[model samples]
Target: MLKDRRILITGGAGFIGSNLAEYLKESNDLVVLDDFSLGKKENLSGLDVEIISASILDDSALNSIEDVDVVFHLAAVPGVQDSIERPLETSMTNFIGTVKILEMMRKKDIPSIIFASSCAVYGNTEKVPVDESTCPEPLSPYASQKLASENMIKNYREIYGIKGISARFFNVYGPKQDPNSEYSAVIPKFIRRCIEEKSPVIYGDGKQTRDFVYVKDLVRALSLIAEKLPDEHVFNIGSGVETSINELAETIINETGCGKEPEYREKRAGEVERSLADIGHIKGLGWKPEYSLKDGIKETIEWMRRSR
Candidate 1:
């Protein structure tokens, strides 16, 4: 655990961010800066941490935070379909907002930042599992924005000496993931539907594969990155094991004993067909996911049952 250090998480009220906060808060003086547009206050309940209700674009909020040891830049306009519909807005948040954070770090002289990038940046790859060496071919505006932010972080690190590591996260799902949201991930939504004895919706052919890393496993990776500050600037944080949508739904249905079949629907635009992360980079840092798909899904289902 990172102790006696001040940490800032930009989107700390959301599912992943809140979980990360819960992990590090006991040892570190943590402050969460979020606009609460997508994040929920209830998510951070009972957590002893400061909350800054502002966006990353808010200069005042960025400036208010001082003496921060590391910054976890997780705030963004998430979701490819949402970015496809609102390209300009997504760019402002995902791209320009990153620039703002880097600028603040430069001014504040914060040494390191662990950026939460997405596997979407590696779009439609012919390669089975994408590693850090794979040339990026972003398919959507969100991916493009994330890629741009990665480059910007690289630039800042090279020129200004601000250490930045971009973590390309695969499909992350766990507790506090809002299934009611329009842009929610498949796992939480599937778990919720199964709990309610309803059919989970499957976009496209249900064969689209994903590397699902549990949220706790992901936060451990993030915490490790913060603690060690590895030499590498990029790492793929995932379970590495590939699972298709059909298989994922089957696991959830079996867990809940909700035998409703998945309802097929038209494929959404700007979504990747298959995704699998080569997590060797982060694994080299002595970090690996502890949860299997079934284990993670069972934990998530229990959380949903209690929260619902």
Candidate 2:
């Protein structure tokens, strides 16, 4: 659908962003803006696209848009636990930074924006599979900031005529997810530890469930959003299946042939008990998750092994 259209992606060097860039660069004109604070250049090394080494915190750096068709705002301080430890920084990057991008897009007359939101905004809810209609009860500053960004996008759509859609992503994982970072997601960290023959550590009872969506599925969803341009919309992108930390660890061990067991530890503060996404809305858009947890885990193990 993106045939020679100019597209800009923030955080294009990160896990999900890099995957999206690779998918779009095959047929679309692509430009990537990232600060390299959390994203690695190595993740984008082989991709043939223009790379802007800049921060979203700097309005001028984000203002250099030229004839962009769509802006995919995927840049932010990711992770719920990290936000609790650094609330101020999280708010600045996620909330204020998104506003800056919106303002710049408005000035540049960008047609539409696909925002990368989170399911953590639902918090610890009684709901099994959280949908877009669920009222957000954010448990951490990061979730709060992401919710604020979605609100900002909606407001901009109403006031400034900037078309936008917010995709609430569940637990996303796959190749190129940084395992060495302090805020690495659960799946990659567990996979890395298993490959090293070390016991993977899980907080609490390891029974807390999450909907793990593969990066490629999310990339396809992003591309679909850009193509469809639904009017001021929101959708959930996930696998539509809830898997616990313990179950996830077992899958990784079995896939990697790791002979170590998982170690349970004290549950961290602000951790959600369970989360799954009701992906009916996105499914209506003709987009469905192709990678099962087992398939994704096996592919991730291969990637991790290659990287090591």
Candidate 3:
């Protein structure tokens, strides 16, 4: 819906970033900045956009790009486990990398920025549906970094008059999500195991819940944010549907027709017990996820089957 605008997507070749690129490319002049450390070139297959293969941390690389309209900052060391094992790497990229992007935007005079924030910033809470106003209790380095980035964005908005919005993403899963990586998300891993007819590994008792938002739906929310530029700076982008891991595994197994059960394992540290998004804020802006869990899983399974 953003027409004739030159847009920049940091980590533009990653799962969510690439999907956003595909969604917006028809109307907007798009530029993707990625280091390919975690992102893949193959992900940008059919997108007709300029690809800048450089680190967000590179000052020269960040400065070289003169972006016009807005920035979708999606580049980062993306996993909680990765942040735990590689705190320095995660902080440098997720936290410092964001600072670099903001600096570039400021220098280039880019008016708007939509940040790819995570729901991990909420940590484990007794509340079923965590909203933006909920006090942040970041449990992992990754969560802390996202929280810090959100704050930095807020400060920049106040000081520099840059219009910034942070979309606190819940569990996002869909096509192109790598299941092979050690730091891969649970849905992709579960889908991969289901396709292989192997037991999907469950890190806990399998009762921990999460609100999964389809990647396509999330990109739509991003587009909406770009177009509307709503007053609220932060919005929770999710399905507003709380589903346990056990239910998710079952859904994937059924969708893939793999008929494998989930294998229980010791609960990992820094893992949240439950999560659901209070999406009322975003919904008020005339946006809500269109995909249900079963449908989204079926689509993801089909994509995986074809990719193999």
List per-prediction Cα lDDT, in the order shown: 0.92, 0.90, 0.91
Candidate 1 on 89-109: residue-level lDDT in tens? Answer: 999999999999999999999
* Model 2 clashing residue pairs (backbone): none
lDDT of 3 by residue, 3-62 (tens): 789999999999999999999999999999999998899899978999999999998888
Candidate RMSDs in Å, in order, are 1.2, 1.2, 1.1
For candidate 2, which ten residues in a row score worst on lDDT? 57-66
Q: What is the lDDT of residue 250 in candidate 3?
A: 87
| Candidate 3 steric clashes | 0
TM-score of each: 0.97, 0.97, 0.97
Worst 10 residues of 3 by lDDT: 59-68
Residue 14 local lDDT, model 1? 90
Cand. 2 Cα-lDDT: 0.90
**Which of the two, 1 or 2, has more lDDT?**
1
Clashing residue pair totals per candidate (backbone < 3 A): 0, 0, 0
